[model samples]
Target: MSEAVLPMSATPVATSRAPTDWNGEAMRRRIALRYAAERRFRLLGLCAVLISAGFLAFLLISMGANGARGFMSTQIKLPVDFPRSPIMIDPAMLSTNPDQVLANANLPQVIESSAQAAFGKDGDDYISSGAVAALRKAIIADPGILTRKVTITVPASAGIDLAAKSDGSEADEAAVVKLEQARALSTGFNGGFLTSSDGTDPTVVGIWGALKGSLLTMAITLALSFPIGVFAALYLEEYAPRNRWTDIIEVSINNLAAVPSIIFGLLGLAIFLNMMHLPRSAPLVGGMTLALMTMPVIVIAGRNAIKAVPPSIRDAALGIGASPIQVVFHHVLPLALPGILTGTIIGMARALGETAPLLMIGMRAFVASPPGGITDPATVLPVQIFLWSDEVGKGFIEKTSAAIIVLLIFLLTMNSIAIYLRNKFEKKW
Candidate 1:
């Protein structure tokens, strides 16, 4: 029955001829249409790039807008007249009406009152009343304000702070008084931003204490981190044996880098401040904490830099009668210098911006004194910024912005230097 059904097997039909293009342009046009029809991927890629660029520009613009005023300052101009016999001769006499006496005194009056005063009668017209207050503060700090009758034209609020502004204009809407206090502050040039201190009143606080603390912290971090990092890197990359213990140690170091920075803060609090009895809020303690956090990173980067150098270079140096240390230092270190330096600057930038660890170690303290040394109580920039941001005042808004700007500038400068160092001296093998 199957053989009978198979008798109907049909012959295969011939396929039709395929179409051919006669014109080259037409063929190209057809291919172009095909590609265009499949172009969704390219369009998506372009959209992604444009969106990312737009987001970046937006961030930069926002930071600039908020932080720009930090570069400018408000000033209060006051006329002063230093008058002779201005000394009250008693602290009570000066204390009874300090502001009143200051208000009544003009620049010429104050200057003329000082034995060291040197100014024409019109000098009072050119000085800031706010500046005179600062001088009075200095006098109060010293035991001399009671007997000193300096008719100082103190700086007033709303006067441009030159250090805080690039353009030095306080008349702009951004710097204008938004609150009664600011309006009150608008009386003359407070000594730019540098003379200010951290306080609940943004009008009265400055970042100087914070600035100095950052410097001291970074200095100690550099001093402690660099040598130790380099030494550890050299041992691990050049001399250490690769065993289970070594592997474990390497893993631990890597894990250390991943640890939350706040953990390091707790560690600093326990080990440095509590256990070791180190002073709280000291840069030394902060630096130690930060360096502990940074060490793992530095070691890793250093090893990578060393590893990037070819073994052949080492062999050549040894063949030329160089000792192991000389070969590594003279040849490998030079080649690795750029990467090492880049890592260092990056670490410094990280440390500079660190807040959590510093917070634990007492750097979160409201330190008003300029840092005396490594062991002195101090407030780093981020801590200062944090403190200022929490302050309740219309002026703190700008002060916070200003502090952020300063922090960003330092970070940017450090990064720029890193880039410069990397590019300027890097050599190809």
Candidate 2:
């Protein structure tokens, strides 16, 4: 009991430490540094987006500027006294075969005479060669014009057209000024650009032929590729046994997707052209070639889309006594359709813009008319643009830009339709 007398002096105590200052300079600096890093990252990302947008804007603006002129054409008005002119044609013949009758009517001579009477002897030089066709169309539309004096407006020559629209040589500028002073020269929408077909004259060339060819080619490509690609994907993903052969096929497909597009062109040339004896420069051949190139892409996309369908869905279907085929076709396929369509859009878009494959198959030929069928000789928009771009004429520059604009519109329209279909089929699990 006496030992407890020294215990109070020997007692140990716990120490108290100061709390961390979250708002202090060091701590605040660290938080600020993290926020600053995030802000820098965001700024860099925004800058990248802006730069990309700027480049796109520049391209679009430049194209629009150059292409807008292509949609317009310059015209010169001339008064023709057809009754007094030495034009030989029976107006009655127009109702049966107007083009032939007009062709034989020596309308070019009448136009030359009218131009000389209206402006000068050199006035014929300012008129486009397309004027004869224009006059023929007008005469056929109004046979009464042949019996009376009337003024007819016709497209000007390429040089005169350039002067009226943008820049030109001194002689062309002078011609333009003279025509303007007479109130004879004017600019109007180029209706021919949409209605006519390719020709030696740029003013008369139209995109309809190439556009139709592209449509036909793409139709064939889609018809051949989509079903086959989907089936291949379904077999590989759902039915194929896990073996070396399947693995080799999968690897081959992946490699094919990465192969150069020109290689596909060569393959098409060798097989479709040399072996199959398919029509050269036909949409059918072009489409078949593009289909070969596009199938692997569709298959890869389809397999991934099918794989993303949950295993539980399959389990549930099986639990309900649903057959394997029924479960895949009714449930899995519907669920995977949106993603598959997305892949189709990508593949089709690539095919639409491709030239080498079609070119190799001889679709680079100068198609004068729209294809009546897939087997008809034709050229797609890309090949047409390529051909136009290679021309030495200044008029083709505008035509090339215009064709590009048309191609872009076509691509956008096609993608929009595909996206719409995808969204329509999209379902949440």
Cα-based lDDT for every prediction:
0.69, 0.91
The TM-score of candidate 1 is: 0.70
RMSD of each: 9.9, 6.0
Give the alpha carbon lDDT tens digit for every residue of 1-429 in model 1: 554466445753345876676678889999889898779778989999999999988877776776665544454322232223453334455567666554554523443333123323432322333445556655556545334343332343323333223343444333333322333223333344675556543445677888888888988888888888888888898889999988998899899988999999999999988899998899999999999988888888899999999999999999989999998888998898787887888788888999999988888887756887888889988988888777654456667787887787778877897788788778543
Colliding residue pairs in candidate 2:
none
lDDT of 2: 0.91
List candidate 1 stretches off by more than 4 Å.
1-52, 71-191, 427-429
Candidate 2 lDDT tens digits, 1-429: 564565755764334767889889999999999999999999999999999999999999999999889899999898989998989998777889887888789989999999999989888888998998889878878898999999999999999999888898899999899999999988999988877767778878888999999999999999999999999999999999999999999999999988888889999999998999998999999999999988999999999999999989989998999998999998899989998998999999999999988888899888888889989999999999999999987888999899999999999999999998888777343
The 10-residue segment with the lowest total lDDT in model 1: 176-185
Please give the range of 10 consecutive residues that has the lowest summed lDDT in model 2: 6-15
Deviation from native of the Cα of residue 363 in model 2, angstroms: 1.1
lDDT of 2 at 50: 100
